[model samples]
Target chain A: MVIMRRVAAGLLVMLLSMMARAELVVEVTQGVEAPTAIAVVPFGNETGSALSEDVAAIVQQDLQRSGFFQPMARENMLGFPVQQSELYYRDWRIAKMDYVVIGRAVSVGANDISVRFELYDVLREQSLLSEQVTITRDNLRDGAHFIADRLFERLTGLQGAFSTRIVYVTAEQLAPGKQRFRLQLADWDGARARTILESSEPIMSPVWSMDGSKLAYVSFETGKPAIYVQYLATGRRERIQSFPGLNGAPAWSPDGSQLALVLSRDGNPEIYILDLQSRQLQRVTRHYGIDTEPSWAPDGQSLIFTSDRGGQPQIYRLELANRKLERLTFEGNYNSSGRLTQDGRFLAMVHRSGGGGNGFDVAVQDLKTGRLDVLTRSGMVESPSIAPNGSVVIYATQEGTRGVLAAVSLDGRVQFRMPAVSGDVREPAWSPYLR
Target chain B: MEIRSYIVPFVLALGVHAAVLALLSTHWMGHDEPQRKVPRHIEAQMIDLTALARREAEQAHIAEERAREAEQAQQAERKRQERVAAEQRRQELAKQQAEAETKRKARQEAEKKRQKEQAAQRAAEQKRQAELEAKRKAEAVERKRKAEEQARRQEAEVKRKAEAAAKAAKERERKQAQAEAELKQALAREQKAREAAARQASQAVIGDIQSYIQAMLQNGWRIPSTARNGMEAVVTIHLLPNGEVDQAYIHTSSGNAAFDNSAIQAVYRVQRFPRVADIDPILFERRLRKLSVKFRPEGLRW
Candidate 1:
């Protein structure tokens, strides 16, 4: 039969060459962003009379300062297994450990203790998070930052700004020419800081209050630069319409009934919005150029601030319902303190790139791919804030000549340094996720 | 010789009885003349005498005296001479019987002419032996009809040479089966062109180890900011012919467990892939064992 149709066409060309060589795939797209090693271990105290606070070194310094984790090194742990049947996952997968927390604390009631933790996944030997919490030995570092916010929201599906709170503005030269500005409020890992308003004069832009209880800064104590909203559990302070010449940049509004600030008293520094129940100030922007740093837009229908109109200090966007003034940064001519990302699709700021003597860093941009990404090469970074799980950004730089507070990670692959025991920390803000 | 053939026919029947008794008597002639003359004379005399006799009687007497003399004349002639000698003996018996019938007819005509020349010499020697036995029987029937026509031609020339050798052995066999089918179709077309050149050189070494495992998985991926541009995942891995990683997981789950553990920590951060350890173990067991990967972040900023 014609040799059976040439042996069935040579078996259909060997079954189409084995269906074109079955499975090899390969895609990937792009990555190398780094950091997620984790291991925390060491918690097991079982309260044998000494449990002051270690809760696994405060969840290994809050997942190592949230630059998205690389924790390990507790003398290089091979075995502090608090439970999961004494956990041996090959001793943290031979110590290359991708996540392993473990737990213990226990002393349940004379002053209430309980703690207990778990979080595993060491390369999927799988137990992702067990949990226990109790508290009160003076809130054991707030129950170890609520177990590092449930192991950073079960490994970064994002919502663990380590129990959030930051609010900077330090200054303190205290003697040479007498400078003592304060505004402080801490714990986003500058530990429990506290002094909310001390000022020898200049206190600058503080911000936070879409329900993290209130604190709107730029204080100059009353000689000038006004704007103070305070109320943090009643260390009370109000001062809003001090319109003489520049009641500095304030912000607030994602329905805390409006605040927005920056007002050159109708002369130059534009952007206004006040409303707090119709105390109505609303003059958005007449723009003669110096419209100061205002930042609202988590959909308060717009206002992104800091402008030089076109000549230099960039960052624009106004639309308070169609008043529409849009220039949103065109890359480096000193882009100013912008802010955005709570899904506003990224916009951090304070860049400087060559149009100035090259010093101010912190850039982010992407607002749907306008692609800027210069997340800090340090040089004197400034107020860049962010982190309500926009993964991180904390800014305020200058280390050797002292101004501290650093942070980074929105894919600039994690940087650290918060250094603030005494003075020079400048304008930081980051607060929003606090229930 | 049987008596000279009866003497010559008895000497010719004695000469014919001597001429008839020799003229029998010729004799009886000569003498008798004389006597008669005498008698006549006597008679003449007597006649006259008788007449005279009477007269004689008278004379008789005279005679009687003479008579007695005559008585003798009487016996006379004695019986006349006994009759003249019986007539010469019956003429010599008829001349001896006619010479014995002419000597038996000349010896029976010479025995019928010598038996008719012997019987014509025996019929001429039986007609020359019957013409030599009819020419020898016509030359033995003409040599048996030419020997039966030379044995029917030599059996028709051996029946034409055996049909021509059975038609030349059927034509060779059919050309030796067509040259053994054409040498088996040229050895099946040279074994199908050497198996298609060894399957195109192993498909070019499996496309260079699939681009060196896609640049070692994009330099060990890290993506997870809850990685969102249609977050994919997939992983798989399983290597070890020295390319290491012997097992990576997350076969498919972008339901985000931190984007599938950042794609199984980017295959354990590329634990090894030197260049797939310089390939070809049968092209790494046919195309680098198990790979998959995928992780779709699309250069993130999600």
Candidate 2:
């Protein structure tokens, strides 16, 4: 009877094996047109030590969070090969995996470790990367992020901002009407969060420098809004401007030599470029109406800023070579906070789609083709920051009463949210590609 | 040279002789009376000495003339007789030639009869040969027709047998296919019956979970004023096995924020879905862990 039961169990397993041939792929259809299929095997640990983090899992999550890859679940992986020779290309191919990554961690010292990984093209039967790196025990997550960034760049032919960071403002309620506002910086995937500034006032309009080493933002810490630049590696910061009325929306030039900020010291809130070395001011916009939120073009030859010169809050481009101003957005009644892409071909902003400028959502406009795409359908969204590659845009949106950070692809295909663990988060600022 | 020269002279002499004879005859007639008178006068003049002699000579001449006359008359009579005999001989010869001609015509008639008989015999022989040849050809043709008919019938019989074999084979194939189809149908019916039993057993557990959750959410949901009946919002809900809601967010919007907020609120307000605990664990994991619920105010009425 026992043998018969064993035979029956074996038959059942065979049937299950046949059924397993039909894989269940969780397709993030809101992602890009075609997402790459990848498998990140559980890393082989040879150190005889209990690690705190799963490096391979972190890499997998990072790739998936980018909305460019559909990482296979760890349960579906067949083998955990630590070396290239042990890898079976046919097995990964049968699982419909386009790429496979395997790694091993070896202890090098009391606290240091050497982590090595190999990325293989299952279809091409070739190794894309096989490298080793030395890092401390706590740096495995960062090492995984670096490996993911390298893989992304190699596969997409563009630099990956996965290893970069994002700065945003988070508000926590202390009492009925009291709150604590903090400027927090974290990895692009919302991991390893660290607060740089915490105050009772608000923080808005955080912008990254060209090299991604410094941040320029408007802080209300001094009882009035002031523009300040802070170095991230070192904890050094200085107040750049404290003009009266309005000194907000500070944007860094591409060469890091100047800042185009909103200043209402004259009559109306207009755009002004301040030479950082000489501290000299150059007025860029003069209109009876409000002109603010000056964003420098990637080439630093022109500035795209929000203005109501045409009787509505529209985006306008101002050429620095000559003082000729041209209106950019003419579709909606209220279009503001225009952020140009690295090529100056696309502009992402908060736009009021319809209804007398009441419903606000994130939108991206192609400058060359004169086409506009509304990225978010839900209104009441703001502060859209574009990635360095211009493939995605992250914006601040409200979910019920809590503010959350949501990202949408420039093509309006994908949408995901990075909800804070506690408190409300807003004003997302995507950093440039970091070395 | 010799015969032409003689013929020309002889013709000329004959012509001359004929002309002279004609003239002499005419002279003699004219002189008939004159010649009688002159002979008498000549007798008278010879009178004196030889009267007696002359008389005697005259008498002698007369006698001689008479004799010559008589001789000439006899000659004329002989010549007439000869001419008459010659005419009779010529008549006899003509009668003999006519008889010979009659005999020749009779011989020609006999030859013609013989040739006619020969031609008739030859025609009869030819007719006999033609009849024999016609009979032989008919026999040969009749024999060929019999042979061909036999061949055609044999070929038809072979073709009929082939058709019969083909029909039998096709019938067998159709029967085999029908039997297979009936067997497949029986198997399918048996499988379907078993599946129906199993599904009926689990129907309450699986069906009640989704419906119960949906009902609870709908009861708590408030359709916003900005929402139309046809607008829908899809929200993805993540849950743990203990019926605790891990996360709930909107996957697709209805283009109206107030309507979307209401739908999101409904999912969150129904904090737990306890019906999932009654279902199989595998079923819950597969179907309910990450469930997407579409909230359309129009769907509630239907």
Candidate 3:
């Protein structure tokens, strides 16, 4: 009996010891919001001559501008390994690179270059992506952006906005008083820009349709502010509305069936929804103050707009079904150009804080938590446009007394400036995710 | 007068004696003459005459009668003598009988005395034997009593000694038990104190390791922007004795591949925790061999 009890006690002790070493769990609730470091090795050129476009540079720039990655400089790389067989993971690992991109470009035809790229995790020594594309020399930059989009999506777990485009009005002072206001469309990185409309009158509030096939903006070419829908592929334009008073800030509904615009035909600047099919206008907000900048929610069930009915310009959500006007921003004196992200969980706006001397800056307010985060410190930032993936907000900010396009990550951690060559770029509009 | 009467009786007696003597003598002579005459009568057997013979016969008859009378007197005297002898014999016999009777009586008396003495001797012997037997029995009883008393005393002594020994042994045992109990208690207290100190030290080491690991992970983590506020990925990492990561995998996914992979990649980036290698091996095995990290991006804007 004594022996049995001793054995039992021994077993109990063993069991307790096992329980002690079951598992040690450590909780990590916070992490550095810094960009991931990646190595974009230069692509090997087998086209017999140097390609006009540097595909590696384009890919690197695209990833860097997304505010989620830090591409290693070419000079810092140990070797330019173009394929997995030649890739030495230890080199990148030593350089503290989390990921590596390697590729090679070969001429498939007289004008077509076939580019093959592969993305790898340096730490894991594993390949993440491998693809091949054939494109003309002119489209080589697009191919690089395409590769950047694929890598970005794989690395950040979000849709890459690199392949999308942005429309911003660039005012070039051709003369002392003559200003050429051009509604320009360009890549999201401000590359390959082209003017959709060039006029001496000012153009404002350029927004993309949901399908990314057309654009609707308030162009002043008709000698008054008129909303025009232009087919981007064909350069076809149509006047949607020409109100006697203010007709501006045209926003496309989520389904692209209607455009939500600001109109003062009712004796005050009010929010109106115009059905593109029926050409019928429906007033949604009847506020006495200037209610403008009507932006559709992703669900198209509601519109968040800037209204000054509360004695100060603030962001408000107007439910289209019930016309329920709920104030969305209370932390600022001037919050305008309220735009909801694709998920309708965050509202990015141009905010001027009530107490601080800081001028208009781009801010994002979490609609769920009602917490507002100022994403930019630029005193003159405006026209905040959220990326389709909600990872970044591109806005227009002044650089040395000239307006330039700049972007900030939603968490207010990463920022980059896109300075145009010869114009004051403003009212930047990020297009939805394009095909 | 007495003398004359005596003399007359003496004379009568002497005369009777003389007459008897004379008759006896005459009987003798008469008997001898008949013998001689019988021979002569035998010789003249045929010459008998009646008268002459009668006269002679008468004379002879007278002599015969005298002889006869003498013989009768002799016969009487013999008879008297015979009677006297018979009487004497009877007396003698009587005397002898009396003597024999006396002797018998005497013998009987002696025999009885002798028997009585023998009986007395036998009784004396019996008394002596009885006394000896009684003395021996008393001695035996005394001896038995002495033996019993001695045995009882010995038994009591033995019992007393045994009790003393038992009491001493019990006292010794009690003291030993008390000492053992106290020693055990002191040892228990010492062991408990040592254990508490060890536990505190182990806890401190564990805490240090936990913070070290947390910092390493945070610095290496590149939170994917797609990781929303509520999404969490749990990763388990196995480490070698040298604090190098042997294996790391997602224990629970956040449903987002990139987010989960980011957490895994963070562990891979750290690769090793040098602080862990410095800790005690036992502590490492118990608490740091396998670790679980929960990657929750609460710092993100969305």
Order of candidates by lDDT, top first?
3, 2, 1
Distance (Å) between predicted and true CA of B78, model 2?
Answer: 99
* All candidates: DockQ: 0.23, 0.01, 0.39
| Candidate 2 CAPRI category | incorrect
| Candidate number with the higher lDDT (1 or 3) | 3
lDDT of 1 by residue, B1-302 (tens): 24236546645765676577567647745654553354211111011324422652464365455546656775545355435433433343343334334434444454455455445544544554454455445545544553454344444434443444445455555565566556445545543553455456655655666666766777767665556676788888888888988888888887878778778776775677877777756456555668787878675655
Show the lowest summed lDDT stretch of 10 residues, model 1 chain B: B40-49
Alpha-carbon shift of residue A398 in model 2 (angstroms) = 0.6
Which residues of candidate 3, in runs, are more than 4 Å off? A1-15, B1-197, B226-230, B256-258, B297-302
**Residue pair clashes in candidate 2:** none
Model 2 residue A347 distance off true place after TM-score fit, in angstroms: 1.5
Worst 10 residues of 1 chain A by lDDT: A8-17
Put down candidate 3 lDDT per residue, A56-157, tens digits, no spaces: 999998888777788899998889999899999998999999999999999887999999999999998999999998899889878998899899888876
lDDT of 3: 0.84
TM-score per candidate, chains pooled: 0.35, 0.54, 0.72
Error of 3 at A62 (Å): 1.2
What is the Å distance of residue A225 in model 2 from its true position? Answer: 1.7
Q: Among these predicted structures, which one has the highest lDDT? A: 3
